[model samples]
Target chain A: MIRMSNISWRFLSVWRRNLIVYRKIWKVNFLVPLLEPAFYILAFGLGFQGLVQGLSYGGKALAYTQFMAPALIAISIMYNSFFETTYASFVRMYYQKTFDGMMTTPLSLEEIILAEIVWGATKATAAAAVMTLVLGLFGFVNFPQGLLIVPLAFLGGLAFGAVGMFFTGITPSIDMFNLPIFLFITPMFLFSGTFFPVSGLPEWAQTAALIFPLYHLVELSRACCLGLVETNPLLSLGYLIVFTLCFLVLGLTTMRRRLIK
Target chain B: MDQQPTAAGEIILQVDNLGKHYNGVSAVAGISFAVRAGECFGLLGPNGAGKTSAIRMIYGFAPPSSGSLRVFSLDVADDWRRIRSRVGVCQQDNTLDPDLSVLQNLLIFAGYFQIPADQARERAEELLHFFALEKKREAKVGELSGGLARRLTLARALINDPELIILDEPTTGLDPQSRHLLWEKLHALRARGKTFILTTHYMEEAAQLCDRLVIMDHGRILIEGAPTGLIEAHVGSSIIEVSGADQELVDFLAERKVEFDRMADRLVIYNKGNAEIEQAVRAGFHSRQCTFRSATLEDVFLRLTGRELRE
Candidate 1:
């Protein structure tokens, strides 16, 4: 029932529509990512650096701020993409009737859904780009290697955005979104090596972290930022790709069921 | 896409046994109708009478559970994109993007049809003027009043220069002034030979605009014809009403075999252009708070669909 052929270049129009809207409020949008890294660096650098000791990741001795900077990028990618597709896309689809309007055009449901996911990714990448520059200025991120995080943010964004859209499709109401954020997103945020190393957790907890899509993103961001790898770069990248593809299909299937019915 | 020119009287849309079911309950049950190339065809019904359901299928918003829908001589299931590219739809809901300005809404919508930039801007400006929304072009959609927003929605629908426009309850919540203005705009568009399929609960709106209309109830067409023709066929030319009627009036109507609705406190008698009937009823019931007037499309609608409230 999910027809891939229904998707075409027409989806870009929907993307362009979101971009037009995004550009209008981009200052408020950029403010969060730009200042968020500074907030975390000051908090961790002043508060946690002296208290935390022997912080070694990928065989490299790292300060608390240095260790947490790349992870902040990972979390931003997750938040930007996940929140956009979940809350923003839900508002457009349900409240604003944006998707309903688009469905009337030559744009297919698949194309609209694809455009939403891609737009979510685009926002995530934009935020990540801003955060990378901020973190690089503080000497927390490596020079050329840190630039790779921008594109990596897009991949991570797609993974999170597709899953977020999947939740948007199935969740009954806007308030019900708390269930996914609490049960899925919150746990991943805490456990997926954002502030602490997964290797330090219990053996089973480390294995479980491997299953979270954010874990793969965190690993990739680290590889790109610190040029150090605990997990193989290809393996982490491949995991995110497969996760994105699987959820992309699920997102389309679920959204088609919800919208086209 | 074919480039052949279509004649005015050609059938632009055809539906055969179209049905839609949501979770085992039927919304539209095997209704069939067609729209010619240059007529204002209408679907008139009560709430949940499958008007929106039927309209959704024609514009490819929802797939029919059964049967076929052909738009512009192309099958909807196989060529919906091609059909949709040439068709415009103004949905019942307020689907306008509140984030964008009124003019940006139209320009962005044009991009959906792959309309070029300069041409889209030109057409967008023309539509803004056509809908009388030129002054509010740069205003946020949320700031516009209901009428202004509705006008913008209609303007956005025309951005593609669509051959067929489907308006679902276009004037549902509009005030009389706005409704009249919209009707005038629609009349102008009809004069231009553009085809339209409209769904509405306002009988006057349907009566004034529809060249032909179908009265639907319980997911089925009860009757279909021109407004005056249906009114004449089903209801009559005139009605005599007597409130606080005595049993004498009821017996008199029964004895005369005059078709009438005998309510608890009122007697409504249908007169099919028989002046004698009107005169007789008026003379008999003139002292009983009686009044006589011409029957309208409302009479036909209420007579067919009944006066019961539908949720």
Candidate 2:
């Protein structure tokens, strides 16, 4: 059972701590999201546009770049939050002993862990905002409607970050993180319809893709970017919300077990 | 600094029958102690003797398996947040934020206690000066030397201006110069009436800083008293070490009912104001390896904990 008293506004202190560090090398941090989408757009847009012809997505025929542009944003959302909580948080917890230091203060383990998730989501939101602006230059994102993807990024970030943090809690060492990144993350990155539409895959494969959280996030991003969605927006939103809450509780529980022993 | 006043001789920490277990293996086996305000108490023990476990429990870093712990008269289980706000902990590990500048480390830590930005900055500056870290304020923690980083950690712990400070082996790996500097700072703080709970295997540190201490081994308290008192009570005022000891000297001491530790190659005779014993051992035995020295806390620790190697 989660003790509600263990959580408080004090978590912002941890968030602020992360922000100060991020701001130190922010130019380097922002470079990835800003240029990553362009790299993918150039690679796919120029290489595949001629051979692939018009692609059908969300019941609308479109250019190859249009179909993959929103997926790039969704992919960035997943990577930013996932990597932040998994590798970065692991270093701080295991190698740096930052969490152990904070535990001696007024902050509880719940607060520190909660701040990690929130900060991960904040990073995703920031990266998504940068990607959205970069993708807009390519005429892939619609104005005003596309801004909603910022909030969607945060939701997706929570889902991914919470799951990543859960992996961190159970992981014995920093080197062991390669297992989840290889098995769990790589699979999702491929089968989540980030590169191509899921409908093109085998019937069983398409059904399996529905279980991947990244697929739902891609669907929501497409809805915001192109005004078209293959699945109901509410269904995608609800799936992300449920996934985030479940993994968040699991992350906090496992972390408490790992650190509070 | 004295805005939050404290009354001396009042109980600041009360640990009763505290026990901790890992996978059913006990780390702390039901020990109890109390610390009054304005006194430095020491927990002296070797590795795996549960000093860290007990320290963790006192700072509310870990929950005790059994018994009650009250800090500042508040139950740790019920009011850990409140208790933590008033307690400063300098962990055994270097937990400084390496990504931050030396000053940012202190400022950010103060934020954890919900200290106002202005107040935190003021206290941070004061601590930087007090710990002699003002010169490196803008330097990243990664750039600081081990001694400087440790000093920064101690400064960070004081950012909240806590009433009680808990230091776990604060000077384990420092050079003699650094250790002496830290001890000097600790002494200065003690003079200001700050309460501290320190854990260290360095008997000299305990002897110099602790008003009272408990020597622990194998998850049990073997003795508790002031450093000088423990030495006086257990090992007396002096010790005579006779290396290359033989059965003849052992027989001589055994005949007199003199307490001594017979080891594989040497005999340690606990001298309680006995100059004749030293004289006889040197002259009567013709042992060239005999040496006489004042008894210290180390003698008491080795005698109580034994010379057996502990993993």
Candidate 3:
């Protein structure tokens, strides 16, 4: 087995390098995601509340803004993870050939993949945290949960980041990236209970939505932020954990083959 | 029964009958060579000659279909990571991160080798200075000229002080002055006892930089020796070029029982010296220009690999 400390150090170094590249355009980094969650809160949470009526869970009516706040946070994490891993990672892989540069060292393919996932997760979690504060400022999110959202956001990020990387491994060009974002990610964001509950959908649609890990992420984030931890939180957590492991393995293996072969 | 000396130096790398096939066509046929410590070995080949494939095998980037390869006493199959840590590679295409400044690129690569941040910064600065790129340290790699980018690539390869440096056509697209600068830098590094394995198509580059080299063609070794030795063995001492001359010299040389090859507009008289051939040309044919010079590695390459342009 390789040394753990070496792997961790390499991962942190790669993470720092990625941050340096991102810091070059910090305005775009902060402003883009900031506008996203705010737009979602104003347009969907406030505008659609009058049309869709209240959401009743356990015979109690939850405010539309509060019910959707955690889901919006989950969506932001997923979007950030997907954006960071897909476009940014693809640029590094194909255009920059940065992985080729790194592989010349002692760093293994596993270390590179893990480092990428960690960076994506960090970016996603930071965006989620900032959006969470924005929600609090607008009096939309009222969770007293002490930083649980951070780890959940991280998990959400890991799931999407791994999945995004999996797509990137198979994508031959930057234009092909649209297939995953439009066909899979956009549908998940719209129908995976991000802005509304999935219960009202058709049985087949609900079943298909259940297949997406984002549905579980939305459910888990909502449960944590609303102080309503269910007895079966493990189910959603288990789904995300399995999704993360599978995509991480697939992404890492495919990328290794693509690079080393 | 035969025996060869096995104690010249430790065989740091060995490839026995290595081959790589793409789509059932061999890019690199069964070939074998070994590199010893402190030797600047070269693979001299034209484009599409499979030098890249061979280097890829040595670095464990691609597994050879049929070979027993070893690096630093470790099997390539089992110890690639260990081997990679001790080796550095500069590919034909520049691999610097374009968005990062020159210094940032070096620091990031040093980080990949798990160097401490402080040491990485210091080494990056030193490498910048070594390449005469200290002034451009803060410039983004995208802004550097081709020569400067290549220098940065070389400097980055030396970040970890690798024991084995592999360069694939490292000076292919540089200006003459840039090429000379790179050669000087490489020579200085070689003086410090760093073993380098480079592949280049330029005959002068091979002659100037390589201590020993293998001429490769169609994925196979055509000849291997020191540059001057190869020229001496294949091309003889001197070649006389007579341009603007016709078949009269050829006929005269034939009458004198002289050996030569006739081209469309010139006759290449291969011999020990220009005395006999110049006499023949002066006595038989009225030529516009006649020049005699010592044979070069280019002639040796042409003789071994033929004059056909390799696509």
Candidate 4:
């Protein structure tokens, strides 16, 4: 039932609408993703650097700023994609009636869903670009190897965005959103190896982190940032790809039922 | 001029026994009507009736559950995408983008149809002028009064010079002045040969605007005709209402074998072109309050469906 051609250029029209509105409210912390990561780096980098000369994660000697910067990069993508697709899309779908308004036109539900995913991914990528520049200025980046993280972060965003949209479609009310955020997203943020090494966690906790999408994103993105190849890099990428496709299909299928009728 | 439509004209939309059901509950059941070119057609029904459902099918908001619906002589099931491009819909709620300014909303909507930039601007400007909204062009959508916001919504609907416009309760909550202003705008559009299919429960709205309309109730068309024709057919030229002292009046009419509907306090006698009903009411209920007036769609709905249309 889903066809990419159904989306086509019409997806851009919805994306353009979002950009136009975003441009108006850019002053209200539009740079939150960029600034948050730098602040985290400054705090963690300075705080940990003073206490200890260095850090070692997964048995690799590295500067404290070096290890944390990559994790923070993945964190930026996670926060941006989750917030944009969940809270922002919820307001647009239910509160603002933007989705209902679009359905009156020739725009199909598929195009609208695709556009929303693209918009979330684009915002996350924009944040990644800013973080990449900061990392380069501070000489924390592995140069061109860090470039690979850009596309990976965007794909990571596609998965997170799709997951957010599925909840947005089925939530009975605005308050019901808190269940997923508190139970699901908060756990992912705390345990996805974004702050510390997931390997350091207890056996049960580490196995649970592996099931979270952000954990795969953090592992893939940090490896890309440091130019270290995991034992089987394809496993990580393949995990993210499978999750992305599964959530994409499920989220869009549910949202189409919610929107079209 | 004849108040009734002289000719049905070229049918632009046709429905045959169209039905819609949601979760095993019927919203529209076995209803059919045709909208012709250059006519303001209306579906008149109460809140829980099938007015919105019927129009929803016409504009591709909901697919019909049974039977066939065609617009511009194209089947809705196969050609809704094409049907949507040519059909303009002004929804019941204000669906205007509050983030954008008045002119920007119209121009952005024009982009959906891939209307060329220059042409989109021209059409938007012309619509602004037509709606008398040029002065508010720079203001955000939320800044406008409700009337102006509704007018902007209608103006946005016209951005593509749509062949058929479908409006769902366009004036449901506006003030009298605003309603009159909107009615005037629709009237002006009608003068330009644009076809319209609207839904409203306001009897006066149907009588004033619709060239042909159906009085729908409980998911079915109870009666449909030109407003005056339905009024004349189901009711008559006039009806007499006697309120208070209603028991004697009711018994007198009943004993005389005159048909009338009785409420708690009033007895309404329908005329059948004989002075008997009228003269009897005048002779028997002279001491009570009696009033006479021409018939309206309200009378037709009550007569045919046995319930007030507004309820």
Please report, as a value between 0 and 1, the fraction of native contacts recovered by candidate 3: 0.83
Q: Show the colliding residue pairs in model 1.
A: none
lDDT of each model, Cα atoms only?
Answer: 0.91, 0.91, 0.81, 0.82
Candidate with top DockQ is: 2
The runs of at least 3 residues in candidate 4 whose Cα sits more than 4 Å from the true structure, single-residue gaps closed, are: A1-5, A50-54, A229-231, B1-8, B308-311
* TM, every model: 0.98, 0.98, 0.92, 0.94
Q: What is the C-alpha lDDT profile of model 2 across B1-311, one tens digit per residue?
A: 33356699999999898999999999999998999999999998889999999999998888899988898888898889888888899999999988889989888998998888999999998998899988999998888888998999899888888889999999988999999999999999988889999999898889999999999887788888988888999999989888898888889898988899989898889968688887788788764588889999998999988889888
- Could you tell which candidate, 1 or 2, scores higher by DockQ? 2
Where is model 2 more than 4 Å wrong at Cα? B1-4
Tens-digit lDDT string for candidate 3 (B1-311): 02122333678778788888887888788878888878889998778888998998888777788768887778877777778878889987777998799998998888877778898898988898899999998998999998999999999999988888999999988999899999999999988877889999898998998888999888888888888888878777788888976666667778777657677787777765648666766665644688778889987887677777777
| Candidate 4 per-residue lDDT over residues A1-261, each given as its tens digit | 565545668778888888888888676645776577678878887776777554567578877787778778787787788788888998888877777677778777788887888788878887887788788778877778888878987898888888888887788877888999999988888888777677668989978887888888878777788875322567878998999889888888888778765
Error of 2 at B172 (Å): 0.7
Residue ranges of candidate 3 with Cα displaced over 4 Å:
A1-9, A57-59, A228-231, B1-9, B248-264, B272-274
Per-residue lDDT of B140-244 in model 1, one digit per residue for the tens?
Answer: 999999899899999999998888999999998999999999999999999988899999989989999999999998788889899999988987888888899
